[model samples]
Target: MENNSPRQRQRRRRPKADVAPAPRRAAPVTGRLRPLSQEDMARISEASFDILHDIGLSDASPEAVRAVVGRGGQETEDGRLLFPRSLVEEALAGLRRDFTLCARDPSQDIEMTRSRVHTGSGGASPMVVDLETGAYLPAMLADLYDAARLVDTLDNVQFFSRSMIAGDMETLRDLDINTAYAALAGTSKHVMTSCSQAEHVRDIAGMCFLLAGSAEAFRARPFLSLNINHAVPPLRFDPEACNVLLAGAELGLPVMVNTFGQMGASSPVTIAGCLAQTNAETLAGMVLAWIVNPEVTAIYGARPMVTDLRSGGMAGGSGEQAILTAAATQMAQFYNLPNSTIAGATDSKIADAQAGYEKALSVTMAVQAGANLVTQAAGTQAGLMATSFEAYVIDNDMLGAILGAASPIPVDAQTLAVDVIAQTVRGEGHFLGHPDTYARMKSDFVYPAHADRQAPDAWLANGAPTINSAARQAAQETLANHFPSHIPAEIDRDIRSRFDIKLPRERMRQA
Candidate 1:
């Protein structure tokens, strides 16, 4: 006989109608609804498996190999590590088939591939020198804010850099806090800034905490994440960074392991040779992530550049970079993973004629190539050096233009704005004031103020600043005008307390 206490008796009385309704899933965006072809899947799977099995690892830190030691990983005399063939099969078998990286703000979320091309500027090469002051500095909190603010205000800019904006961070060691703060200040969507310190993964992990309020927050709405490179040799994982990747894996934050492919240097000069190298390096990292946590989400990417054999300078904005970018993205897809790589970058500064040509070529190719994630969007000049606010403005306009070029013709009844176009053609209709025009123009047409369709004399009267000057002023105004979305006072205080930093008086809330 069961004893029914009063509490148990009361629990049985609850009615089904009083329960909360299940949440509804909104319709997936059109691009998200598209499916991959069998050939598409084959190219991705075959190339990805080849990378996992036959390719050689480069500069895989000492500890990385050791992580697989007893499990059939072998070590060389000089400390290079090698994994047996079985590891490749095991790694690929467990990868999650398909899943959305849910957005923190559900309204902002989109599929891995989307109609709108998301892009941003980045400067994570780990060295910055301020020419104005002739000072060498380390990454700091201010730089993170500058990066975040840069991302916040621009409708076209979609990501932030991971370097100090105004300082020389050549010698800075405490990057964990600096990286963490940048992501926190940036928009509450996709952001990549995890600590390089293993134990301090918690510090970066805390930002992910606020983004969704739980580790489970990552399973659906991943926000803050990390990127780790398999150092040029398959030797070992840097203890600090490895720990962070492990933590991110444990927590389910996404990571993109990008290898810097230096053709004729670290990689073979042949495109095929270089792809094999970069792909192997990326796959090794992906396997490591799975080893750390089965639930970890990872992407494959490379910023591989050809080295001019004589000059040794990286030809990042060169034509070959696009081929490499496209090919590698294909390989990542073979593994059924998302990718991130550089685009819209140039070695030229000042938005000159050369700048326009190089940026357009590089960015356009990557877009048409169908890379999932692309950045190096703005202000990447002199090989991603010497910050120019104007350069960012120019890049913003260019990205908007590039995205416009990528738009497929809308075939739906709404876009057929055929009736509206006809009315305007007959000279009896004012399209500008039309409701249909108002509804569609902003979303479909990206008009540029730089476009001077005026008479030569009228253009001269307007002072005719070059794209450079217009961009410069735009960058300055952007920096001045942007502000973080207002966080609640309690949340702001908690964020500040975590860092032990005080807010400036102007930004502080009234007592």
Candidate 2:
């Protein structure tokens, strides 16, 4: 008997004329908010070259000094590494301009070329915002895994960076290894983490190689990347971080050359001056990556925080920070380099009104200005010192609105709906039941799950939950049941046996 139900018959007879375009992992933002004009970018680039040639970065590593000098850079008697303009230009031309960051699951790979505007969490905050108890406490390894799990389910958050440092780990070695393990266990999306020593980088790679089935397979499609802070403020190389950078480069891993120059403190107070110094610092890192292996994929990382001159403290939530992030994005474009910057951080301790405004301002600017990757874009508070689980859901809704604001609206024959308007005017005086309206209902709009949109009386009937409370409920539901099965059990056991993974297997299991 070949009997078909009504639902089955409807599904079989569905029209093929309504085929929608394939959605991208992250849509490329076309809006351009270049605070610095083309002339200004040129002037900034020239000034950066001057700083590199004249003021030169301080180098402590013998290998780095040799690599630079061998490549036409000069070393002063005081040990400052001087880069000639030609050398900087040559490195810029030779650097890997574009690449894809692969993930454990092949479907989650991210294209790192152009201004694609992928937002993710960052900052490696040391504290966690306990929404249940409403207390800020030292973040633990469990929190890190939970954060990754939450990110895996978020649509707007494209990738997961180790958002919080595992402060509960007794040693730095344990912290680094466990952080890597937790992030991997939590999601199959592209994961990025940092290592305290160069050896940790190799150890993490070995773990990843095992997960990928072989060394060659891992190298062919390396699923993990490193975010190494290759230099300290005021132009000095961090020796240990430099080693990590070189290790990742030699292994052909994607290395983000993060440079942090605080305005009015580590760098000049003016926005232009800060960009110039940070740009020079970024160039030095590129040269180092070139010295390691010219084929290494480079991500031009900028985290130039603004300082409050009145109190001599960080003002990460200020408008100046957002402006600096957008301006630096323009500089990365000027060099034709892939870029990432910090946004969405707030000085507010909780995810309240203050946090809302602070995150909205910076995140919007970064998206509109066309940053390739914007870190600290979710689950951050207290000036990048803490992460809140509830904030993840709330920020996801906010990021949806921001993406909507940045995404272009199509104005085609079907979209314009002139015929639909005429039909409505001639007949029912409404087009809600029209075929065109029905076809566009779900695809043409972003419906937020945590944000409230009910009528006043209906809202009161449902207990009138605040955004934070609604977000908390949503986050609780996700954490309670969303356990991903990307990594096989046998592979997980092998990894645990091979490395000192601190996160318990039971913790990853859903209720």
Candidate 3:
């Protein structure tokens, strides 16, 4: 047993030439597409200001009215709150331009600054595509947790923004709290969720405190943010959502004043008209957030969606939707504010050819235009009506390639490889086994984990597999094996003791 055979000796000395390491995580890529000229942006800004001043908005909560009117906002005879241009300008000037979206793991922190783009999962889809059955089903708390685990393992999905609504949760409070819990338990990445009531904001913050060890600790690096839909399109504010926005701002939680206006339905049919209205609504939300807490981190989330005029249905994956979102990013750039937009919400029910092309087209446009945060960029389907675990796996490969395309290219001496080219020409006649090839292969190329790239013979020998089938297998494997334990057991117990935690521990771990 002690004698080493020839085979064992040869195995020990085998070269590791073919093994390639994983590509580095994508850094924030600079946006280079400009859909709107300076003159176009100026006209849109003026139109937005006029809308805010002339039309104003209705149904502002009493607290919001007081906060805004106290700061020189006027109220029309019709009870609509009007924001003065000067006041809006003042709030914009005072907004916090750059802040870090801290994660449970410090290395995952996202810098919220200029045209540096980031993409992640987001939506409130009520249904999920069953991974095994291939049937559409109601999304439960368990489905949300599993999706979070999938997102946790995804290299390109940078954050989790509560992709699915837990239809099993009966009460709104339970829904709000458990949604946040599932996201927190499922990933160490920065999490974002919505609160049903202002009081529920405090409850969620307390749970975050336990996870971070103390209230001070959580506040120092608050990992959770609220996506507050404070504006209801066509010039109005949702009073309840505004209250939640105020509560979140009071707690110093980073908030996105998200506004969605569907063209030809909730908003004007023309693209410019829709943009102007949504832009005004977004600015109004910012004013309210600034009034409550001047230091609060508020993101300009102006999502102007498109509607299929023929059917009056949401065309979230249409070319019009793509350009509209990119133009919104340009508007945010004009104001020098951190912004977010929706992309890749394919109308296709499954991850088919339609879904693939739709997602790639919209995501490419959004990222190229430089959206600070591109939500709904992964795993969304059926026009944001459904979520798919397998879609997350397939979309991860697509996101990596899109982000890689957006990455800056260097044109320096080292990258030029003049010397390496000359030496290869003189000696090997090719660069296949060259040292520079070995050094740059991993750094320069982004290999797909789910997409296939095999020759015809190899494919036939390996049992020709579709991308969907491969992604399904990958999703099932990851969900069965990966379970994040960033929050300790004792802390989880405390969290359950205080809140109505519904996701069973056994479901979270392998048996």
Candidate 4:
């Protein structure tokens, strides 16, 4: 919040808040190789290849090509290893500079080229919410359906980053593929392979692989990616699941290594200590990945915010969350990698004042600090236990304003008030109506709203809706704007086949 002072204004009154600052930051990047010695690279390369043979991927069943070896038999009942050394490097060689993530609808296609892209979907999974009704309830399928639709309409979403899911693990696999397929069908773009069990991650990766035409397709044009939520096992990977991340890398897939730390949980009371532990794990993962395949293109991710010791859930609404995210952004930039953190996430259940304030602050700080992709951009409540559809909608709007911030303008001419200088005839000098006034003013202004303000009566009149209402409206409007693409019927069929669910007529109609 820049200060608007009369004394300051009198001192210099040429420029207004509308003028954008010059672009100072470079484009955010991902999958970057930190400067390593040739020997180090060799060691990492050796380590990476060794992993393929020694640590094979488990649960790869598509008849995709038995094991990473093509003869071990797909879906090893006893955790079979598929990928070999050569394949990891082979796939990495073909990865592209950038690609498009097809939305469920064609119009929603996201361009993954420039840096600083933020996106999300599925605020909540249909987990067993022992509502006032009963125990072990799944997320509403319509909730996910609406989420996919919301992903289509939200401009901020770069990739269909999955958010929430149904809590039932028994049916999670079906739901995972179901959600991915639904996102593809309803929206028309490539959806993301997301956070599920290790097997499910592999399954989704395979689905994405098939869609792009080959095991290498996603590597070249990876619209779909996944997250390996690292267990902060004292800065170590659970040996069982770490293998999954290695396998994904060998497959030339992108992944978010989200290492979360809660204050009084895995993290200390201080932000720095918390960040250090979290960052160490994140860096170690990337290091191991560089060992696996420097080409894997990892995003150093963290969500090290304070935790509520009493409840043992993430304590949202602390100013430290954004600060930690900002600091993490700096760390990522220091390592020349893209950083992923949260946005539009708050512990508040209903979208009320607290939700609005926390989400906005968390989101804006992350973007401003340079998180390439804000993960939890919308639909966070009750320590991520619940989500509001309306909150997500508002998040989209918030992003429009934030992305606008990324395009800051700065230059000698723009900053230098030439007209003001000229108008200053040495006496009543002022450039209130300078020729460049209108143009400059339009460039850098995020107008205020009544709710964002403390206006009492004004807030009530405008529906006085909670975040739930706003998210619901957002989700509704998002569905109304669904776009479709011309994915080949064969490709569409193959994608659906994996799910063992037939594509509905609605999908075919999407062009």
Candidate 5:
């Protein structure tokens, strides 16, 4: 009964044993795109140093002035704080080049170092698109909590920053406290939030101490950081924000000193001039942070924004914006400091074709250029003026693909599969049924949960759902069901008793 024919033998041959795919874990992807050359970098560095020595930044806080002056900084005749080239270079040399942003859950910690990219949600959008009615509504504390929960479930969104402002809060103090509480209670991921006052920073640190059970414990593993916009463009320091930065630095909280320079508006019209100014501003922040705590984890947040010359508004979704942010990343690399930049802030009011292309181009460029932290990488819309729950779900899919492209491609003897290819050529003429195919299926490919890839017939059978509709449905399902309870109930009660936590506990649970 043995046919002994070549076809029969091939059919009877057994495939190799199936190997399990590696576990899915979020690791940093190294960027490869270089938007600036060596000469450009040297010229910009020199210009920035010149700006620092000559023009100096005005309106430095008393504390910042004291710290910098004690460390060899000078004051201009007009009261501007002048950082000599020597002081700046020494500060840069002493800066912490790498550090970890710890999370409540240890698994979510982000390692910040050279050119390792991580994307997350960021913005202070005042409005959020209503999930049920699709209307722009003033963002509330509940919306921020819900956004954090949504980001917690998204694999590609690495961290959760406060994406929207709690417009309903009566006071800035309440907004800052509740924002931190909501972000922490919603997810165990590392949180970054802005504080309105120095005292609020201490209060939040107190809350963090309670959560971690001790001040030492909280310091050992700080789960939250301060995103201080320390610089106001046109070469000035924000005095209030600088005070907050000093407080955060004293408490040993990791801080991101963001310098947002809008071209043709706050900064010089020319790109080179804009870069030099922003670089000078960011370096000023670093020097201040260094004077406070030489060991503090400070990130150079150089966010160079583009302006539409005719309309005189932010063109966040433009190609110019993409290259500008990418070039900022290069400037950070030039200093050998941990850095962040903004991308994915689309001008489109909604998640549409325009939003897709704009977000993709900018985020891809930032990631490729090796920005350590890519803020506003998801859920932003209308030029960072609003955020949408549906966009969070949709952008999650897009970020995964972008990160996948940034991931390394492996080449080896097993992967080359010369023997397998030869066997296939002599036998089945295909490798579809091979064990390697099954083993590499999940690891090698990233499948989108919302993007439609079905054939026309199958797509029609499924009612031809648009990405927005699918994303909306997915967002609804998540909001309705996914309520995170990482913080223990007893600890939460203690926090509520001590601080004026505004977000209702019931809203954090399923309805």
Candidate 6:
């Protein structure tokens, strides 16, 4: 029994000042870099609709063909689905704009209201950069779980997508089950992962249901969502990917319909042509989702990838890649849909000079363009083929600064501080010891935890740590501790009994 007496209640009550909301702090402000005008957007939209109504898509699933034909669409001689302009428009109009991405803990939920931009980690890399030797090694299941734990503690890296592939799992069944388990156990934040087969979706959903306590409770607030690469670009549905998308719809889970096309190869060489093709393919995917379940929540995925004309490989870190991705975010807003896209996936193998500029340029551009979820923002290198633990921590600091730069700063009467300035100049002769300066330190400034900001003498005296070393130290410290235990012991026992979970429970404990 608990005490509910008046004295006990009064003692628990916090003072008003402590409980009350703090003063409105100023956020760093910025605008879109060379954003498209309204007329430019209209032109792109018209071109996209024209492509869907004219060129059409090929080799859709039998379910998709039936659904399209039933919904006033036509099938080609070779079995392609020709979506009329009206069908695409209807799907666009029916999309749900506002929804909540629930986490294991209620407080970690992300509201997709599109109020401000949020950056996080995302990738499916096969290799991991060793924290001790800075060498690339095959990523294992343990690395994925450790990445989740590191992401959980990083303040700026808000959500954790499946950043690395568990190369140790020999079977897809074990991989899927343990991947979901590692993510759920490592972090309470929202976790997004993809599946190779439709049945895996149900299995993962069952796991989520168990975590939520029941099927009905899981449906009410499903914490897990699926990232479905619903279509192969140049207008064709990937058979397996489409099945996964439909499965996600059947479970009422949020689906991210990502359409990836390499410009100048799968799509046209011109930026406008690429956007039009991608937009049309994306709309076709939305139609498929609506046909499966009319009320499914879809995330508009815009992967505006570029190809290096010289070598014909992906130019993920190029300036053109950043520009195209930023502009594609504008297209997502045209249909009033929540959007996610790739950024900060550098082509560099190491977290050196090349990596810094490449990641920062793309990420900053995406934040300024107001993307809802910026994927590949952390722990990605070598054109998304590898992840670095040190770079993950460094990228968290970079994302914090990027977000701070994008934040809106309030410049009003109170912020002017004319009185404070005069008082400082007259009495102290400088603002260093001023009361206002001390009060505004936290409110006005955004500081990087891993970045060194000391003078030459102090820096030399402290052994002059580089960014890479500093991030490595932080990553080691975080992985040594910070094991979250939200899932109960009984639930863990039941999950282990039912599924083929490979991650050892004892390994989750700190040494």
Residue pairs clashing in model 6 are 28-407
2 against 5, candidate with superior TM-score: 5
Of the two candidates 5 and 6, the one with more favorable lDDT, higher being better, is: 5
Candidate 3, TM-score vs. the true structure? 0.95
Residues 133-174, model 3: lDDT tens digits: 778988888889888988988878999999999998989999
For model 5, give the 10-residue run with minimal summed lDDT.
Answer: 1-10
- Residue 88 of model 3, lDDT score: 97
Q: Evaluate model 2: give its TM-score.
A: 0.93
The Cα error of candidate 2 at residue 215, in Å, is 3.1
lDDT of 5 by residue, 1-511 (tens): 1123232233224232232323445565675888789899899999999999989999998888898888888887788998989999998999988788888989888889788888999999999987666779788887888899889888888899889998878898898899999999988898999998999999889889989999889888889999999999999999999999989988888899999999999999888899999999999998888888888889899998999999999999999999999889999998888999999999999899999999999999999999989999999999998989999999998998998888877899998999999988999898888888888788888888889999999999999999999888777767666778889899999999988988877667654
Clashes of each: 24, 0, 0, 39, 0, 1
| Candidate 5 stretches greater than 4 Å from native | 1-23
What tens-digit string does per-residue lDDT give for candidate 4 at 1-511? 0122231122132222222223222333332222334454344345434444554333333322222334321233566443443554443443333444443344445544535565564345443222122233345444454455555554454455555573422466676676666555545444554544556667777777676677765666666666766445334355534665666667777766677767677766766566555655565455445555656666667777777667776766667676767666666564446557766667776656787788778777777766667776765566676645555656666655666666656668747766568666664566555566667564455442212453668778876755444444334433444434545779867776666543344433312
Top-TM-score structure, candidate number: 3
The total number of steric clashes, by the backbone 3 Å criterion, in model 6 comes to: 1
Report how far residue 236 has shifted in candidate 4, in Å: 3.9
TM-score of every model versus the real structure: 0.78, 0.93, 0.95, 0.67, 0.94, 0.92
Better model by lDDT: candidate 3 vs candidate 5: 3
1 against 4, candidate with superior lDDT = 1
Worst 10 residues of 1 by lDDT: 25-34
Candidate 3 — number of clashing residue pairs? 0
| Candidate 1 segments whose C-alpha is farther than 4 A from its true place | 1-63, 66-72, 76-78, 97-106, 113-117, 125-140, 161-173, 233-240, 412-439, 449-453, 500-511
Off by over 4 Å in 3: 1-23
- Cα deviation of 73, candidate 5, in Å: 1.0
Q: Which pairs clash in the backbone of model 5?
A: none
